[model samples]
Target: MNQPPLPEVLDLAGEHFHTDQYATYRDILEQRPVTRVRFYDGSLVWLVNRYEDVRAALSSPRLSNDPTQQTDIDLSAATGIPDDLSEYFRRNMFRSDEPDHGRLRKLVTREFTVRRINAMRPRIERITEDLLDKFAATGGGDLVGAFARPLPLTVMCELLGVPEEDRTDFQTWSQHVVESDPAFAERNAASYRSLFECVRSLVRRRRDEPGEDLLSALVEQRDAGDRLSEAELISTVFLLLVAGIETSVNVIGTGAFLLLTHPGQLARLRADDALMGSAVEEVLRYMAPIEMTSRHSLESVEIGGVSIDAQSTVLINLAAANRDPARFEDPQSFRVDRNDGSHLTFGHGIHYCLGAALARAEAEIAFGLLLKRFPGLELAVPTEELTWRHVFMRGPVALPVGWR
Candidate 1:
């Protein structure tokens, strides 16, 4: 039997979600849902492909997110992330387990509740319409830069009470934090330092002059009973800013790209407003922002007949899991009618995404108003020529579009 193309086979697949490779990966899944492979650093990792297995591994108590519990596996050394950059990810809810995760998540959960997100719909709709107006006036523009990137940045800025004037600076900081090029260590360091300093300033200001925003609330919590430490506050803000902007930006860009490319799905969503919610779900499934997540095994474990040793790195193939043929029929096809919410795009169980609701809200309004306002919207350039950001998250760098 032919084996699937390993990471060695396709070097750039790490940054770009090569859907074309899923066919080969699907075949691998049939043999064993979890397969061991060597990463670029020659470090071994278990790739979890099957949807059920991915979900199971994510929710399993055996899996440890706590860096303390797991053996030494420095993300900085492994990924070329500098000490300070890695400091941003050192410890928090995402890397913590159980009580810590629950406590940290609860502290900020109220700010992102479904109702709160829904309340922002009217404001989001206004933001969408205003952005569409700019695109409409220009006849055609780069949708990713003009619309997709700005909408989420705007929402996050408002939620965090960041002044509108500071958003441009904030965007610059975020781009560097997620930089994929391991070669540019000096450039990455400069940007990482700038971003850290910016966040620190914001935290200090919030501490001095508390406000209605999340940062202030968190600062108050920290001051009261030491609910959040300075490091935790910085990490939470960094996570919210990066995860908030990047995911929504790509979702809008990729979802819009898919809609424009798939006339049938576009028409289905355009004709019915009620289908907007499910349409967003399909878009998310089709274009998962965070394609993969890294996890390290706490102890030796048996998965798919293969023995994964303790301290082994693991890769959860989220993009592949969402498109697994075993779970969904015509997995490659873009179907707005599909109602399966089992997609691991936002992850599963305890590690489920905290910003899922806010993301859905932003996309629902952004896409809904986009189609309604510019019915003639079509790609300005040939799809093949469009540049894709070859990062952990994939999206068109610039989605230029034209309309009547």
Candidate 2:
């Protein structure tokens, strides 16, 4: 097949891209479905914009999640993990392919099973109420800081048996680790070291004194057999802590922001409790927590009629795919009851998020309790003044909300 000429490389690290992503995505999806984009660090990746192409790229065997498979590109540098800590940070399932991905995922899959997640409902509710009680007492504050951020942090810490006293430090380190700004490179590296040492210490504690927590179970798995190595064990815990907490925080915060911004949708949800599930799904589709994910092409591949060279980085824009008009009707519109199809927010294929079920459960409980408690809930500040975090994970830094 004759390949189409590549489009001009666009800059994706600019403030415009961060401030108005959906608009930028819409333009790309329509005019340049398959193109290359340059990041702030001058690294280039082929950007897949349309829904079908993004979905196909995500599941294609030719695209490998493991960075080591790429020969031409230095993915290790792209990851921004300091050299000394790279082994500890990059050895998890999220960054692996094939047998290794399956093995690492299997070790913790049961803990996030539907049955296990469902079992967490009572405790999740209690945590939600406790957070809400504090918010209610103050009348209102930055919802993201006071409620959304802490809810998942608290849940994840409790699940992993992280000491209550250490949670503040953990949260601080996590924020630094996940920040994508080049200015924070030094801080990010320092945070990576801090996080690695912290998880390593937790692993030792779990090994010496096993508890009923998930981390302890993983520690036991390592001790009982050679199933998991020390690096793998600690890395898996780190992945769980960062991935499990940050994504949920984005979902809950973004979900509430969507609800407050779309009054009609909020009104419909308030009137019909059955719309809760669909509402959450809509939020995921409309404003995906993680906007884009990256993979490396192991072999030359064609997507949307554009041929990509082997070892080339390809970025799947989840937020753009979710809003592709080819897959969704009125894709830009936010509707609580609309059930077009499943969105790629939790993604598809082998690398689908393992904590998806848990995130959904937390969001449902959080929103249900929130609306019930504050029927008049609304944004406390002008929408234009709100600031979003410029990172892979998308959410407002602080959502000041009020209810009277």
Candidate 3:
């Protein structure tokens, strides 16, 4: 049998990757479904672009999420995370495979169930209202800073029993960890250290006091048996903090931007309140918060006719897959009532996002109440003037909007 041709190599970094990512993905999906792309720090990975390829790559057993599985790469060093501290940061379910992944996921699966998340709706609404009340008082501000960032951060912090006063520190530390900017690279280790230390303190407190929060529950499980370890516990909290907060923040911020920019969809949604759920799904698909996720190929695998060697890194472009024309009708257009829910924004198979339900509920409440309260909401500045965060996740750094 003949081997497939090597994938074309391309550089994807700086302004183009951050600002016009969709266009770049489109070109790759149309031409090179699988290509090797060099990232900011000069690390190379096989970039899978098409919908089918991305979906297959995400669920393929051949692709492993474990950093330790990579034979040729020091993932921690490549990503600027210290080798010694990498285990604490990467021990969570998202970075695991097989029995360990299942074990870690099972521990927190119940907490994020649709039922549990729905029960928190009332509290989520109240939080939204409190933030909106402040926004209304000011009449306009950076929606991200004033509302989008805080609402989810507050929810995650409260869920983890993080003290109110400690949230600022948590936000700063998480931002440093998630930001993809080269400037933020040097701070990654320090941020991870801080986050681990903070989580350790919280874990100790939860073990002693045992509050009604998820951290307390996790601590109970850890103490009850060997079901959970100290490192895993800390990592779980870290995952929930960074993953839970950032995804929802982007959804709220980018969702708002999408609605405001696409007035027709916004108007359609406003006219028919029933479209809120569909609108949320569309926002998720159209502007995926987590753009791409990397996995280590456990063995040699063929994707989109390109062969990936054993222990090679593969980056599945979720944003590209979500908007692939082959899967979505008018993939470029944002429609409130598209009602198509097959997008891989929450991923698929074993590693599907654990916080999907909570993120959706928070977004629905945030947008529903936001539109209801401020019917006149519009961009505070020209759309081109708005800046996006160049991070592991994609969202506006600040969404300035005014309801007046």
Q: Give each model's whole-structure lDDT.
A: 0.77, 0.87, 0.87
Q: Clashing residue pairs in candidate 2, if any?
A: none
Candidate 3's C-alpha lDDT? Answer: 0.87
So what's the TM-score on candidate 3? Answer: 0.96
Kindly report which residue stretches of model 2 are placed more than 4 angstroms away from their true locations once superposed. 1-7, 71-79
Show pairs that collide, candidate 1.
none
Query: Tens-digit lDDT track for model 2 on 1-404?
Result: 33334347777777547778787788788789988888656777788979888888889989999877765545434445788777788789998998999999999999899999999999999999999999899988999999998999999999999988889999999987787666677788788888988998888888888899999999988889878888888889999999999999999999999999999999999999999998989989998999888899988999999989988888899999999999999999999999644899988899999999999999999999999999999999999999887647799888999986
Cα lDDT of candidate 1 equals: 0.77
RMSD of each: 2.5, 3.0, 3.4
lDDT of 1 by residue, 1-404 (tens): 67644443333335323444455556656665777655554445678778877887788777787655644444454444568566565556787887878988998899899999988889989888888888778878899989999999988988887777678988976776575555554566676677677888888888888899988888888889898777887878877888889989889999999999999988888887788888889888876887777677878876656677887777777877888888878888888878777788999998899999999999888888888888888998998888776535767889989985
Q: For each of the candidates, give the backbone clash count.
A: 0, 0, 1
- Model 1's TM-score against the true structure: 0.92
Model 1, runs deviating above 4 Å: 1-24, 30-32, 67-74, 77-80
